[model samples]
Target: MLITGRTLRSLPVLAVAALLSVQLLAPYATAQETGRTVSVGTGEPGYAVNLFGPGEVTVNAGATVTFENPWFEPHTVTFYGDTEPLAPSDPTAPVPTNPGEVVEYDGTSFLNSGFLFEDPFQVTFPDEGEFPFVCIIHPGMAGTITVVAADEDVPSQAELDAEAEAIFAQALDGLKTTAGALAAQPISEQANADGTSTWSTAVVGGLFGPSDVQQFFPASIDVGVGDTVVWESTVPTPHTVTFPAGPPPFPEDMMDPLAEETFLAASGPNDAFGGSGFVHSGVIGLDWPAGQSYEVTFTAPGTYQYICLLHADQAMVGVVNVSADDDDAEAQATPTAPATPAPGPAPTGNAGLDGSGGGNMVGMLAVGALVLLTGIAAVAARRRTAR
Candidate 1:
């Protein structure tokens, strides 16, 4: 009877233990359902390159952003715009990882900073803005996060138009002149001439002319906003004008070194207007951003200089002073083959060199005999023609 009474009392205790287990497990199971999954991988494909499975994830407040570096490369999973890195160390214990997520190399770079462990990104936005970040080692590896205010409405059409117009003006009005053309212009830049206007331009030898390339012409040039410059090459060898620097980004660096952003003008073997020098068909052609032009045109309001890569010293430089204007332009083919001198129409000494050739032999012999008496007359006529 005593054993039966003891068993009856233990039943209530057992019931209490069962109730405690339910309470502990319920919250954890709920957490997983609400949590979001972000990824950090090599951004490449194949087993060698693991990608972010979800790529992107969004969750309500108090939810977690789980990051997994599935590949061998070290990765970081940090909150954008946050002061400190995520994936903090656990003094008491190492952070636990889910299946398929592994932490590899601990390089001094940010990846090893322990910024992407099981942790909270800790921030979310209600308004629209962008957050861009990158993996320093691999170029072109970057991601952005944008948040939009739930209540904010999109901008009207007028606002968008104004923004585009502003950008258009920014790109034009900054090109310099062409290769030899800039050389001939006033180098001193003053409305008046100064000693500074003079400089020995050795690069002009490539242009074909024996005349020394003087300050009278320059290899390249740059200009301020709303200006214009031109180029005309003297060399029969086809030359091109190209600007290496790309289009303007901000207002400060708008004028790149010359007007071309890429292949502006693709001239035929007989034409001009490419980067630095002329390139044949086997070579890649010029390709610039903002826009390309062989003829003179304002390239979005900036200073630009182009030169011949082939003949550095001759056919060398071009300047385009692009400015804010509606004027149009195109790449014009350079005229005339300087190397191939054209044939003339006049008759020559060929007849005299001939052996018994061309027209009446007997009459010619008689005329030759009569020439003894007419030698004096012939001499007089020759002297008169010489005078």
Candidate 2:
């Protein structure tokens, strides 16, 4: 082949164009090679409770299905029959009974990906079959995967992504509506003459079932650095008030020294801690006659964000804006209706509480009445002390 200088110069241009084309097509090729990556939960603001997007998916036999958890909470992808699914009323009840049950996938063998948080779990299907899975922690959360013959066509990555987007959008709208309804309820408050404030946690709504979802009565609040803020759980379900810990002025020290050390030891490294100090109120359960309350006096001035570790991903988050000016704190503090007895009966058979019998409405009512009376008496005593 007789090569001319002009032709040689054109060769470089052609090669460059080919390289650009390959670069652009790389993503699509990789998507196909990787099979399908299904997002297990939504990361959208205020709507993180979704179980899965594209609740059902189709993939070629022998293709790998990657389940990704993008939200803050932990989830699992366990095939039906792999293990007993916990009742929706008592999701956490299974953990004790089914601890460390890891199943290895062997085509016919049961498969279960324990709880996953901010990570992805992958399982390859070597045969054609329909597999249904659920998050044992949330039995109502279920999905299905259809594995067709190798030659059958499956939904592409683009299609799955679009479907996920739509699902998340709809979930976000539902969350906003639920949150707004809860927000409309008058927050119960009892302001002290000493300039402290308290906010109660309420069962706002449920994700999988009744009372599964909860949030801070006043999701946001303002206070002075020296002022104390207290959070009391008003429901039987357990919850934690957790602030990401890291950087200077850790808020853990603001709590009891013993509690702070205990939390640090259990929480391990604060790799996820951005700048705020880590502070956690260990599992507040119904058995705590004191109403499972936690109080922290802000030592530094800034906007601190916190969450109920159990329901954080479900948008159960709150914020506290601390200022140096007492006047500013008092002005910004949310006003609330006077404290009153919470209407609903407390959950039954909670391990901490009496645990006499399941669904003890009368027992629950008695407990509620006791709590209401205690709150009233405490307020009166505080007023007397102040006088």
- Pairing residues by index, what is the TM-score of model 2? 0.53
lDDT of 2 by residue, 58-159 (tens): 998888877776554456677754455554334343232233432234544345665664345677777788888877655467788888999988888889
Quote each prediction's TM-score: 0.20, 0.53
lDDT (tens digit, per residue) of candidate 1 on 1-387: 001112222223322332232233211111244343344442110011222322333333333334444222233343224433332112211222322343221222222213332232222333345544333222233454333454434332233234423432222111111212332333332221421111122222221111112111332333333223333334322233434333212111111112232222343332222223222111121222212223232325553444333222211233444434422111110132211112222131111101122123213322322221133224334544656
Measured on C-alpha atoms, candidate 2 has an lDDT of: 0.50
Candidate 2, residue 325: the lDDT equals: 78
